[model samples]
Target: MMFRKKFVLFFGFVLFVTVAGAQDRYFTKTGKINFTSKAPMEDIEGKNKTVTAVLDTKSGALQFSVQMKSFEFEKALMQQHFNENYVESDKYPDAVFKGVIANNAAVNYAKEGTYTVNVKGKLTLHNVTKDVDVPGTIKVNGGKIEASSAFNVLLSDFRISIPSAVKEKVSNSIRITVETKLDPLKG
Candidate 1:
């Protein structure tokens, strides 16, 4: 009888841990972010594929971190000016967003479907942080979750300024797109 009780208790504990570990958290390291600026004279774009992100499906919490200098531009001069004059990557090497999903309960993680969610968070870039609420989609397919969103950010909001010499070549408003496939974090 004692051995039976111990076996049941141990099995229950293992089951509890397995359920807890499989449901709550998701993470990704090779996320991708793209930013584009369209102006009268130029269309500039930068892509970065080294983003790190985490999501807690149970608590609606989401976070992202990326290196500022990781963005790659098509032209060398534009990339140089972007890091040196605009974002100042040396001083602010990282950009982070920490926020929560406003209506996280609407998404049924157990089901395979797409859910639209509103993410409310603070975006920090170039040493400045601002409140941001964006619409994002979470697609759950084959037990995999794909998160994607696109939003526009003003350069001046992050203390990023374009020099007068190249002001016409760059737009003050930049559109950023984020994409990532998160994997279940298992212990």
Candidate 2:
């Protein structure tokens, strides 16, 4: 009887750990990120739908990565200039953000509601990394979490140089928007 009792306790502990680990992480592959450049000559915009993001609900840790080349611009020439001249996608293939939700404790992930949170992290672009704190919303509904945020990025901060000839066509700052629907990570 004692041996059977020990075996049952061990099995119970294993089950608890498995369930806890399963509920800690969430991920998404089809995240979308869009950016808009408002200049005097024209408004330039691009969208990338192949972003990958991961969130740890337990720790409020979040990270995302997007390929610079994956961004699609309406004008092919604009896209070419962006990749070759501005961002240099060939040299810097990906842009990434790794950060945590600053107000994680205020968010109750077990309940369904929308929570406004400030995310503090480092954004790497054009081979430059900068610390950023941006306000964003996290919505928990039916076991899924949706996160969205919009922020502006300065080109000079990332060391992206705009040519004197076309500087008027592109703005010094760009508006960026990110959205993702994350499901629980599967074992």
Candidate 3:
């Protein structure tokens, strides 16, 4: 009958949509990023919890965006100097990374497991972009994907300069750690 054929077609369309949506993408708005600077005179640390990240599960593509002013430091003066002088947040408001997982075939997204992979991307900070390859871990647990990485960024690479007066208080390289729990994108 015509009604029976129409019902079958509608059911097939819905099933196709559901399957396509399941593998679409994953994203998070409240990711966490931390940076630390260690020197003989002092240790400086800052944290930003307002980072946004997206991962395309079907293509192994990953991207992140972080506002420079969102980073909170322990000392108010240090934070002020960081934005106004070092990072120049007014000119370069956000830092971004866009790239893909190099070893995508090793991980099974449907199954629950932790996989170590290499991420090659362009990191843009303080108006400078650099290509970097870093080791990261992707953990799939309970239908959620958690991606994390720890890496070092050199100040000179981003054109960040340290004042001579406080040169001893800061490190030339900063240690950065990123962690995010991503959920499937909903339509």
TM-score of each: 0.94, 0.97, 0.93
At residue 136, give the lDDT of candidate 1: 99
lDDT for model 2: 0.95
| Predicted candidate 3 versus true structure: per-residue lDDT over 52-171, tens digit per residue | 999988788999999999999989998999999999999999999999999988889999999999999999999999999999999999999999999999999999999999999999
Residue lDDT tens for model 1, 1-187: 9999999999999999888977689989999999999999989999999999999999989999999899999899989988999999999999999999999999998899999999999999999999999999999999889999999999999989888988899999999999999999886
Error of 2 at 64 (Å): 0.7
Please give the clash total of every predicted structure, in order: 0, 0, 0
1 against 2, candidate with superior lDDT: 2
Q: After superposition, how far is residue 4 of candidate 3 from its true place, in Å?
A: 6.3
lDDT of 2 by residue, 41-115 (tens): 999999999899999988899999999999999899989998999999999999999999999999999999999
Top model number, TM-score: 2
- What alpha-carbon RMSD in Å does predicted model 1 have with respect to the real structure? 1.5
In angstroms, how far off is 75's CA in candidate 1? 0.5
